[model samples]
Target: MIIDWQHHMSPRKVYEGRGGQGGVVIRDGKVTIHLKKEVYQVEKHLEFMAGAGIDACVISSSPISVDQCRMCNEYYHELGSQYPDKFFYLTPCLPLNEGAFDILDQGINEYGYKGVIISPQNAGEMLDSRRLWPFYEKMSAYNLPIFIHVSGHVLGYDAYDADYNLNIAFTREADIALNTLRLILGGVLTAFPDLTFVISHLGGGISSTLERIERYIDVRGEKFWTDCGGTPPFGAPYRENFRRLFDTLYFDMAGFEGGMNAVKCALTTIEPNRILFGTDYPYNFHTDGKDVARYIQDIRGLDLARDEINGMLGGNAATILG
Candidate 1:
């Protein structure tokens, strides 16, 4: 019953006529890949899953344009339908698009998508912006989790304008962490208490920085709101409110090397039930399926009980997705 919650599948058309090098280019310490052929090769993917001992995966696309998002969702829906038990998928939609809610409704009701995937920031609007409230409200009503992932291109900065590895390794996490903090401190969780947000990359370092963030709130609560630019009405008892809101969020263990130290950090800072297993597969393919096993082993080697381990491995995701 092991589930990998953060796998990606790209649409086939992206690599149709690409040159050798298989649509992958490494320039200036950044890896730019158009995995057109590999993403749609379902048989190979299933074989990889079998070798890796993964029972199921939630498939999403590499970030793309708004029209491409619809196309990717259609392809993923077809794939999931063909292998319902082995695959689930998240619907891709840009929150700012006029038809975003329509896409979500059709994807969930008609296509059987399990959730939705969004970037940390889209078109200069952060996830907590008022413009996204309708999408959040729709997802909350359906009780489907929102998957937050980041792409170097979609970020506020120009992707090719800087070194890729440096951005991914360092700057990306900061952006994700900042966006997550905005969601918490901006009162998104308070406003939509039932919404389930599963942020990837271990909350982009949120677990590690929780104490510092809380302390900042303690010392400069007023300035925090002022910096956020709007005095949105979050409930009273600000400190406790912050903690409660944070506790309601969930994180997926994706994008990190399989190591016990990160797991230990997460366990210490976040609730066991709020953590989910995710391999960030295909992206980690250089490990040849070993990373998945290592991640499982790392969690198993922790001081956690069997039930806690089970929850991290699959149970938590099952509960969230259901």
Candidate 2:
């Protein structure tokens, strides 16, 4: 019954690693960056997906291009063609490319992709870069939420600084928050108004900014968080911005445990209906849905109504994919 928002399938070349180790050897806790195809073979992908208990999985890619995006779009198309209803698509948004929106339109009309996913860090610049405005416009037109996912490290500063610092997760989390703020300050959210947006990795530290990034008005007089890329905190200039800002947004509980504390706090601050259930499958540290189900069980026992749990489990996502 869980509709996972973020999932990555292996490319045809994924099985080509040494002894078929799959590229990106997880060397010393560092990402070596391998060719996408060599890491995600088709057969292994379907085998991993068969019993995941998910109604549908929207596949995303790392830092691939318009061509790779096209390839993945077709790949997901084949999966959807074969499975009929189980497999879905989320075309990638090429970084800083003029053709990104064209591809988005192509994915929608040609491939029937449900939505588009852009790496918050690699998204045509940053999430806030004005260069991405065309991309946002199309999303608003389709009423689709752009799911922001990171392939590996998100921070531009220390992505390869260390062999994988313990703070890598936190770094990506901060990257999302900063990028969201950049979008806010840059007027991406306010201008589009209805272009839906979703952030994976538990929304990339977005729950922390509910007070600051107002959906409607730009708050120039708020006590903004410092971590949100030098912006002021939530206050007068950004009043109902948060209200509308949060209106069509949602987040997936991907790596729930690492940021469970933040996720719990986010639920309290934002509408419980906006939180969606997702388990980063195939790459999950825990076993499967049963293990990820614990988080939902806890939420059910919380003060939240049963209806809210239903929305988080599928309603919100179904709304997005539709």
Candidate 3:
């Protein structure tokens, strides 16, 4: 049972009505995303899944306002109800917002959502903010994973040109890496040990830099905090073994568009069981179902054992989602 954990879905009428032909720009043009009919049209999405040999996909939105999250989640819940085998969805909400816990509870208790998707950073607030500890605590108690996907392209660069180039090249990936580290260094992992987090885009290419990040801790020791000009965040203490902490999180194979090089790189630091199959569909070239099938074949062609391959395909995610 292969589960593509990073599939995206939006309501057809809401998406098309927002002036998006093949795509749309929202949030006063602060964000732009390509939206295709395949994103919302259920039959079309199912066809792509079949072509790709995907038994299921855990779906979520590209980017939408918190105000609209409830409605979108309801729509997703309806889809899941209609086709339980083909669709499972992650509900989205901003943790900082008032009544956000209520929103989350309703999504879980009422709508039967599989898990929740949240931005790596919300309105410039990092995931480790104390205000969000309540959110993390609730999620931990619920025993549901938190899916972190980079949103809004909020890289701190000031003068770079070309929005599209910046986002794909340097913006979103960096945010994913930075926030992944923040959740570690900021001590969220230690505080909520039972929490499960699934990071998108292979942790924004984390395999390439995991050692260097870990090396800082090995060389700097406790002084690493003073070097950063601050004490450890109050009430949030991190473990000395950053790699062990990092291993606790899961990564999804997407955004590389089926490149074996990236997959190979990720495997160097990430265990095969910790990797989940993901196709950044309807947005990348993988829109054609054949492309995703090839992507799966390439993973199967890797040197890993059958069990390892099967784990990445879906077994690991089943354990996490359960």
Candidate 4:
């Protein structure tokens, strides 16, 4: 079965109306994401999926407020209920917000959401904050996978303030990679070994920089913690533990417009079982449904075993989502 694990969806009304109202910031008094006319049309998504031979898509939204998050989740629940075969959804959540846990509970117990999407940073709170431990602990106990996606929260540096550089340049990817590392180095991974995390955009190009990251851990040894001012979760050989914990994480092939370069880079550091198929639908593949089919073919064309191809395409997601 083919699954597009990172497909995004939002209600047209909400998308059109929300600008600087919720967490969405109107940069220079200009809205960045112009709402597509067909964004709220589920039938169009189904057509795209059918043309691409896609069996399912896990829908999610990057909402602007707590109320908007709940609204989007309700809409997703309605869609999932209406088209059970074509859709599964992630509960959109903002950690550390009032009624955050209540919203999460509603999605799982009331709406039957399969997983949850968490931003890299929320309200200036990074993923490693101690306040987030209870949230993580609850998710771990529920056995719901966490999807780490960058929800329009860019790097705080002033350098990216112009030209939408955060979205257009490498800054967004860097943010994801940095936060993923934060979760590892900041003791979150060590604290919750059973939790599953699927990062989008191939973990923001992590394969290209993992060697340097691993080497830092290797060279720093114990002093790394001392200099950084954090207690080392495990003993010596931090590099090995880093790899072990990293291997437990999953990555989705999305946001690259079906290009092989990013996939090849990811293959260097990520295993096939740790990869899932995704078409950043309506964002990257909106114009042509054939593009989705072509993307799938590109993965199939890779010089790998049949099992590996099958796993990357959908089998891996099936196993993980189950």
What are the RMSDs of all candidates, in order? 2.9, 4.9, 2.6, 2.5
Best by TM-score: 4
Could you tell which candidate, 2 or 4, scores higher by lDDT? 4
Q: List per-prediction Cα lDDT, in the order shown.
A: 0.76, 0.62, 0.80, 0.83
Return whichever of 2 and 3 wins on lDDT.
3
Question: Backbone clash tally for model 1?
Answer: 0
* RMSD from true fold, candidate 3: 2.6
Question: Model 4, residue 263: displacement in angstroms?
Answer: 0.4
Q: Candidate 4: give the clashing pairs.
A: none
lDDT tens digits, residue span 1-322, model 3: 8998998887866676657577555443245455577777787778788889999889887445555676677788788778977878788878877766677888899888888989887767887778788889889888999999877556454554454456555667887888898998888987898999999999999889888877777776667787878565422123346777888899999888888899999999999989999987767654448988988898899999999999999999888777
Clash totals for all models, in order? 0, 22, 0, 0
lDDT tens digits by residue: candidate 4, 1-322: 8999988888866766664233333544323344454567777888888888899988987776788888888888778768888888899888778987898899988988988898888877778888899889989988989998865756464565655445534666777888888888888899999999999899899899999989988998988888877788777778999899999999999978888999999999999989999987777676447988988898999888999999999999998778
Writing each residue's lDDT as its tens digit, candidate 2 over 20-78 gives 55345453455534334423554544544444445666677654556666666666677
- Report lDDT (Cα) of residue 47, candidate 4: 84
For residue 63, give model 1's deviation from the true position in Å: 3.6
Which candidate number maximizes lDDT?
A: 4
Global lDDT of model 4: 0.83
Q: Using alpha carbons, what is the TM-score of model 4?
A: 0.94
Runs of candidate 4 with Cα error greater than 4 angstroms are 19-25, 28-34
Candidate 1 per-residue lDDT over residues 1-322, each given as its tens digit: 7888998776666435234335454534465443435566787678768777789988886444666677777787777658878988898878787676677777889988888999888777887798888888888888888999865543554542564355666666777888888898776887888888988888887778889878877776666677767673464566667888888888988888665677778777899899998877676653357656766777887788899889999899988778
The weakest ten consecutive residues by lDDT in model 4 span 20-29
